[model samples]
Target: FRKVVHIEQGGLVKPERDDTEFQHPCFLRGQEQLLENIKRKVTSVSTLKSEDIKIRQDSVTKLLTDVQLMKGKQECMDSKLLAMKHSFSS
Candidate 1:
């Protein structure tokens, strides 16, 4: 959902900072709710037809691919930061 995407993007922007107490609890609860929703959506498969299963599989696969790409990007950014730090230190 767009709301989840916005929340995730906002979190990434300040990934190194400690969230304020007022914001932390609400953000945590939002994350928990998102996780629960995803779990429920994924784990309730008993009634799905074959076509529905295929659709869900496609969506899950796409999501996994996106996550992998994001992870790679983050790793590259971290490496760049480390390289910059090393250059400054020397």
Candidate 2:
């Protein structure tokens, strides 16, 4: 003859037995808080990266505009120099 033991309160039986390695409530809460902190840090770093890129783009645009202005000035000076040289030679 064989005897059967029932550990669960209801008629439903769990597929796996409860292990002793379950995490404490406080430990689970601390893990959740750590995860949230990591998410916040990631978001702030992403925002900073976006701002840095925008600043770099603005700097590049300003530099390009300055270069164009310099080119125009150089062209005007070159024409004046050529006219002066021709007049001196004649």
Candidate 3:
């Protein structure tokens, strides 16, 4: 008989609070790292392995881009939510 891999979400986490000050990179670098030794999509997978230590320009660039864009994203979200609230109540 073959084995089946079953996966299900715990659903205990609040998606909005994940990036709070307490956890830093939400779930500490990633829940994937703790559960499966997986790293961020654009970072070094394993520091223990020399082959995985190489740095690519795009990797760091994407991180910086994300940080810089966060404020703008929040602003857009805020405006969209306000508009929706007004329309919803109208």
lDDT by residue (1-90, candidate 1, tens digit) is 223333644755755545443222234543666444442124556777999889989999999999999999999999999999999999
lDDT (C-alpha) at residue 53 in model 3: 41
Please give the TM-score that candidate 2 achieves against the real structure. 0.47
Q: What is the C-alpha lDDT of each candidate?
A: 0.67, 0.66, 0.58
| Model 3, C-alpha of 13: deviation from truth (Å) | 46
lDDT of 3 by residue, 1-90 (tens): 122222332345445433322222334443655644433455445644654344565678888999889988999999999999999999
TM-score of each: 0.47, 0.47, 0.29
Candidate 3 lDDT score at position 27: 42
Output the number of the lDDT-best candidate: 1
List model 2 lDDT by residue over 12-41, tens digit each. 655366532333333455366644333211
Cα deviation in Å at residue 44, candidate 1? 9.3
Weakest ten-residue segment in model 3 by summed lDDT: 1-10
Candidate 2 overall Cα lDDT vs. reference?
A: 0.66
